[model samples]
Target: MENLKHKARKPLALSTIFLRYFMLLCGGMLLWLGLLIGTYLIATATGEILPANYVEKQIAAAKDILVSSPEIRPDQIPSLSDYALYTQEGQYVSGSLNREQAQKAWKAVASGSKGGIRGYYTVIQREQQQEVLLLSYSIVMNYRSEWLRTHLPNPELLGIILIVTGLLLQIALWSYLFGKKLAKKMKGLQSVIGKIQNQDLEFTVQSSGVHEIDTVLDSLDTMKNELKASLRQQWEEQQARREQISALAHDIKTPLTIIRGNAELLSETAQDEIQRDYNRYILTSSAQIERYARELIEISKTQEGLKLERVTIDTASLLEDIEELLRAAAVEKEIQVHMNAHNMPDFIAIDKDLFQRAILNVVMNAVEHTPIQGNITLTAEGKSDSVCFTVDDSGGGFTFADLREATKQFYMGDRSRSSGNHHGMGLYITQSIMLRHGGQLVLGNDEVLGGAKVTLEFPLS
Candidate 1:
């Protein structure tokens, strides 16, 4: 049972909950409306019957008086001054009758003397022993007033019904509008979440014209953006670490190879002078280790973020400097290093030191990859928006995968074919420097030289 309960899923949305509550409220309002109308009808019916019962009570009281005083003369009866007075013509009269006139009128009616006509009459009689007057009276009941009471609702009850109905309608309308706005906001948020799930972290939720919903959406958007930024930073850091490890391995391999070769030579020999040779071999290995450490430190400092000192660097002079630096290495390999320029601009905006390092790295890479007697050509050309430096070699070209991963740190195509000093950090650092200068590095197969081509394109400004 616990497992099953755990497996039970949460509701997909809160909309259903809101809908349930809204429906309940609407139902309650409808019930109230019904009750209001029912109460109005009941009150109207009771209101109509109240006046008739009051008139019946008054008639009964008059009959009691007549029965108690049978000796009263026709002109000496008790007056109904508290009741509404009317004339014989059924119009409102000026004044009410006195007790004597009331008694006279009642006695005349009991003695069968017709005085004035009335409508809807009821009579109560009493017996007497002596020759006495039997008092009677007529009342003209207003049937129009009674009919109105029977058919029409009381004003207060009607007003209550209108107020309640109006309130219910307002509640329903407001709920409908709020629900629509809520649904729209929810849909927008759902779309944003869907995009986020698909790893598209660039979208934002649109406002839904509701303050609370918009505020929530804004907060979610901010959180998603922060998460995306953090993840991207972590990924970049991981990539950097992997590259560092690969570069470290590459840097250590050369000394290890030389050490192993010298050890093998010493093992085959059986002379006392072999110790001196082994000592020299160990010293050489130590030197290589020192060089590797220094190079690693320089690489680390560059990657840690070097502040650029901007200067206008002459492209032609920079190319000459690179040529002078690589000439010795090229002479050792018997490779020809050629530098050429056509329509080259004299100066470009750059940090002279960083730009020189970037250019020298590419040239060194070309020289290292090219075999003996191969040609390494360096060319510079200025276009409208950018200046391009191209290095073309006549060595074996890179594979498709190598070309794709060329700028990645410690991504070497063939270690044996590369120069012993090759640590695969040259191109990676070159690419990073180019990016800092608002430039790019392009790697492809050199169609003309049948070797690798590396182009560094820098913005003209």
Candidate 2:
């Protein structure tokens, strides 16, 4: 609150900048207006307009022209707008003015009116003759040649145009200057935001030359630094934990192998049936523990992504191994396991251990869901550019929820199909393996078996 109060007490510099620009605009226009008026005054003072005696002076000068040419043609008269010779009866002889304009001028001369046909006029007389000389001229200020006078606009209208055009130009100039300043500051902010959006947080945030935008940039920079540190720390911890679990699982394998070997030897030397049963129990339990340890190590590897070691193996041999392992898994349930290994590639490239494990996972899942005496079919064949292995079990088919989410990690299906022992990692592991081998896992209900059908497709090339 103290900082806020101190900052608030300071006057806004942005407002000062705006006020300065506004004042400059007003002063500039005033200066331009004054310049126009001053230039016009200087020109006008230098005999731009004739004095009041100009009409009387022109009349006195025209007496000689009237004596020399009684009938003055328009072209014969010099230094006048128009000229005409008229009798005492007001008849036009020759002049630049039309008959109507001449009559209007004649009326003004006869009645001594103050106004005539839109210009100044004067008349000259010779006392011995009945002829009269009438001359007409515009009373406006003169400048430029006759062509320019006829073509150019009047001074007042031209001044108004210049002032309006200058005002518009000033408005555009000031707007560009103000917008360019604001855009410069905004561009700095946009650059920082763009870097953050592109996931590139390694940059130095600079001032935007504005208090408000700089405030935002400060906060954003703080957030970026904090987020980067948090991500680095999180990644380090996760990596350490995974490494520890993998090493622990690997360490357990050796002792577990020793325990299972001792149990197997004791079972072979059993003298009583009860002792044999106890030996069998120890062997079975140890085997389960060993399998769990192996899966734990593999799962840790899979959690990131799996890497495959492809080796050339006979397709028939691979299928026979899968069939034997799957049959052993379903022995307790008394399920009939059948294998169809026809029309397959003789030798195919595959990761032997990983591929067998993926096949085992799918079949083990089927065994768990299938009832006793149920039949499980295994099909192996090549189609197009891929080798496909499909497992179908004679049991209840997969529900819609299972179809959609069975392969997702930790997604245990409905209790009716999953039972109590199933942990929902079988299909997930199989899918990860398939993906590593550039393949895909497909799930559906088999029409013939009337149970879940799982197909694993591995690319041949």
Candidate 3:
């Protein structure tokens, strides 16, 4: 008990399963933040330097060309297409420049300003004259390139991509690792419960490393083993009882035959009328006893389950035979027996003897319950996937208990409803035979006949 208590308390210990997962989540967030910050910093630095470096390179190249030669003349200077040279009097010189552009460049240079029109510029004294030089470059390239560079996956956008990618990758990795650690055990439990719901207990339950789960699985395994053993023991006992019944029935048959034969002989040899009646009673009782013995033997065989020997038979012929066989009994009782087939198949596959016996049992049960001058109807009809055999008797209908337990073995109703000769296995044996043929027996009160209604339904193969 102490050990069990300790086991139960194990899960409540200061365990780190949740803590570990929480830490993994925190680490993933940290990684996403780190990647985002790093990407943003790098992209921002590059964004700043790229356009500045491009403009600086262009300015440096132009400066190198102008200052590298010592004897260069203003008229013979190389063309600076991007720059507009201007005199201190606002006149354009040594470069391609429109009048307005030249005036704008000269104004900035002559006013001793540092900036130029449309772009940056510088003013310098000429090498041999007091005339100042105005140098300007177009602002279009620098502004357009800088806008494109900053906007085509800019720093903010790159940072967002990096963070999203990092988070997604981390989530995938964490989910895979977590599932590997626990999902397998949960899946095993799910499979076991699913099979149990289906009433399948054949598979083995393995232990999960978790104490609580392993305990539950162990308990389930133990329960399954106990149930299996119990069922086996019950099956063995039922088989042994069937064997004893079969042996007893076999042992009684010879003596019953002798008694029947002796009674028959005595009926012929008897002189007085009373002696003949006594002999007749002996023969009748002997026949009933023999029938009981036969039924007992059949019960034993039926309990062992049925092996069918199938034959093709038609519904019309089958019904006709039943009517003809029971015609004498009905005539003796002054009862009306009717057998009919409607929309029944011409041919059906069934174990002819067993099927006939099952039908006869139900019909005879009705016949016994019915009063003289009453009506008994046996019906056969074919359905979509099966055929139905029904018997109705114009007698007292079944009670609720009869409807519930009529087909159970050795079940008898009240003395008023039950026959003294009945051993109560007729409907039970009939139902068992019907089940063997993949069919069923249904019992209900027949309103039309004012009696019991028994239906035997057979599957069409």
Candidate with best TM-score: 2
Q: Candidate 3: misplaced stretches above 4 Å?
A: 1-15, 35-153, 194-205, 229-237, 240-255, 266-304, 310-321, 324-352, 371-374, 379-389, 399-405, 408-424, 435-442, 457-461
Most lDDT-accurate candidate: 2
Superposed by TM-score, candidate 2 places the C-alpha of residue 300 at a distance from the truth, in angstroms, of 6.2
Q: What is the TM-score of each candidate against the true structure?
A: 0.46, 0.62, 0.59
What are the per-residue Cα lDDT tens digits for candidate 3 across 216-329?
666767766677788789889878878876897798889888888888777667369757755765675566557657767886887545567889887678777667545644
State residue 91's C-alpha deviation in candidate 2, in Å: 9.9
Between prediction 1 and prediction 3, which has the larger lDDT? 3
lDDT of each: 0.64, 0.77, 0.69
Query: Who is ahead in lDDT, 2 or 3?
Result: 2
- Residues 177-253, model 1: lDDT tens digits: 76785686578767877887888887646654444545566777787879899999998997687567547756676
Displacement of residue 2 (Cα, Å) in model 3 is 11
lDDT of 2 by residue, 1-461 (tens): 11121233433356666787788889889988999889778866775433335445655775586666645555545453576667878887657778888888898999987565647776766444576777787555445346645676656666789999989998888878988987886886798789888979888776655667667777788878888999899889877767776898898889988998898777777369757755665676577667667767886778745667899998778876787678777878999989887678889999887888788789888998899999999999888799899999998979999999999966888885667765566898799899999999999999998999999998898
RMSD of each: 16.5, 7.4, 8.8
What's the lDDT for candidate 2? 0.77
